[model samples]
Target: MIQIKDLHKSYKMGSNSLHVLKGINFNVEEGELVSIMGSSGSGKSTLLNILGMLDEADEGSYTLDGVPIKNLNERVAAKYRNKFLGFIFQSFNLINYKSALDNVALPLYYQKMPRKERMDRAFHYLEKVGLAEWSHHLPSELSGGQKQRVAIARALASDPKVLLADEPTGALDSKTSHEVMELIQGINDEGKTILIVTHEPDIAQMTKRIVNLKDGIIIDDHKVEQIRASQYV
Candidate 1:
């Protein structure tokens, strides 16, 4: 569903050039679960931002599904992001004042979807994430896992083909992190492609494949045994 070839991103800092992505090339198939692992400054997050089109790559080619996005204007990129990509950040990025259902429904507002239809879609995804009973609660009222669930629900509300998650389990305890992983894995099984960025090896191990990034390039790629069930044990 996604192909990135010879991607390069650099920032001009005074007289020096800082390269964030160094000719990275990768492909993610439909319904696949993939993870990118890297240390700080290794550029996994930058790659994720570029993949989500939150940040533009300075050079090379990026094709989503089949459309070329290497040179789309901001307005077009934003529209494409809303329509085709779902993003989950390390910080959850939920509005503190909005209820879980409202938070999930925010993305659909730009499409001018009917209120009833938007509400129906948001509520359904909330229920899918096991948050049906808590839809009305604000982010502050939820636990870490619950907040992440809401984030996941928000990402899925648009029925995006691919979900881009950055350090999704970064804030949770190990047990809760496993639960979130199970939820992500479930999404992949149901045919949503997911690419997650994680620094933890154990977390990366839960996905179908692992790709390690170093110095802005993919250094290692390996396919693990497929997850038979949610539980790692």
Candidate 2:
């Protein structure tokens, strides 16, 4: 449900210009899970920021759900982002003093929903992520996995159409990372479009398809089902 054409981003260093993404083109469809894999400096995170409206490409055509987004006013873009997109970062990004339930309900404040309703939805997702009893616990009181659960619950509180995660499992232990991936997989199964940027092959494998990028261009795209089936004989 998203499209990008001729996307380019550049930056100026002290004495040289660094072109990160060059003429990139791709589409992410509804109900599909995609992973963008690359080594450091490959622009995977840059691509995700642009897609999330957190940054703008120097030149490109980006249309989300059939509307041109390149020139949307700041307020308009923010509104659309709040309505249609959810983000999970490598860092938990939780308010240290806030309880899990309050953190999840934060985005709903932007929607102007009643407090009770937001809390209800937040509780539902927090529980869905196996954090029901931890709702009243602050971030410091939770483990890394539990904190990530709060972050995921916050993202879902918006009922966003697309979820973009950047190195979602980067900071967690291997076992915790696996648990988080399963939670993300469950959301994708429910038809939410998901695009994740991860350097780990195991993390990329969890998605339906993996797109490898290098030097700001896409190099390989693989369908997980095809890869797995071919291995079976």
Candidate 3:
């Protein structure tokens, strides 16, 4: 469902260019739950940004659902991003004043969906994420786990083809993190392709495969015996 070949990325400092990704290559098949593991300067974030179309590679190619993800004008890129990718972040990235329901509906609003339809779809996904009763709560009113659940619901409201999560459980406690991963695993069970970027080994093991990155190149990539997060929860 996703393809990358010899991807390269770099950033310019004062007078020197810092290379972030060098000759990176990987492919994620539909319905695969994978983790990209790396340290702080390992270029994992750069790779994720390119995959999410938030940034472009300086060289090589990326194709999402068979469309080349290069040279897209901002408008076209936003359209394709809405149609093909959903993002979940460690920070929860929710607007403080918006309630859970409205936050989930925000993307649909950008899609120009009718008001009634957007509201219904938002509530449906809120229910799906087990946050229906808390739909009216603001981000500040919820606990860390609840806020993250709301974020997950918001990400799924669009029904994008793939979910790109960066440190999805980084801010939660172990138990809460396990609970969140359980929800993520359940989502994957229903066949949504997911790529999680995390440094935690346990979190990585929860996924079906792991891609290790270092100095902007893949060091190892392999499938693992999936560890159900429910066992820990």
Candidate 4:
């Protein structure tokens, strides 16, 4: 479902250029749950940003679903991003004043979906994440796990083809983190292609495959016997 070949990225710092990703080659098939694992400065974030189309690679090719993702205009890129990608961030990126239901509905609203349809879809996803009862609660009123569940629901409300999570369980306690991972695993079981960027070994093990990154390149990529997050949750 996603492919990258010889990907290279760099940032300029005055007279020096800092290379972030180098000669990276990767592929993610439909319905696969994969984790990109790396330490600080290992280029996982750069790779995720490029995969999400939030940033452009300085070199190499990226094809999502089958369309070339190079040199597209901002408008076209935004359209593709909205149509094909969903994101979950560690920060829970919800508006402080919005209730959980409103937060989940916001993406559909941006798509110009009818109000009733959006609300229905939002509620459906909230229920999927086990947050239907918390729909009226504000982010401030919910626990970290609840907020992340709301974020997950928001990410799914648009029904995108790929889900990209950055440090999804980073902020929560071990129990809450496992609970969130259990939710993510359940989503993947239903055939959603999901990619997680995380440094935690246990978090990466929850995925079916782990791609280790070091020095801006993939050092190891392999599938492991899946460790169900429900065991811990």
Deviation of model 3 at 22, angstroms: 0.8
CA lDDT, every model vs. true structure: 0.90, 0.89, 0.96, 0.95
Q: List ranges where model 3 is wrong by over 4 Å.
A: none
Return whichever of 1 and 4 wins on lDDT. Answer: 4
Clashes of 4: 0
lDDT of 3: 0.96
Kindly report the root-mean-square deviation of model 4 from the true structure over all alpha carbons: 0.7
32-112 in candidate 3: lDDT tens per residue? 999999999999999999998989999999999999999999999999999999999999999999999999999999999
Counted clashes in each candidate structure: 0, 0, 0, 0
Cα RMSD (Å) per model? 1.3, 3.2, 0.6, 0.7
Question: Which is the winner by TM-score between candidate 1 and candidate 3?
Answer: 3
- What does the lDDT come to for candidate 4? 0.95
What's the TM-score of every candidate structure?
0.96, 0.94, 0.99, 0.98
lDDT value, candidate 1, whole model: 0.90
Rank list by lDDT: 3, 4, 1, 2
* Candidate 2: RMSD to truth: 3.2
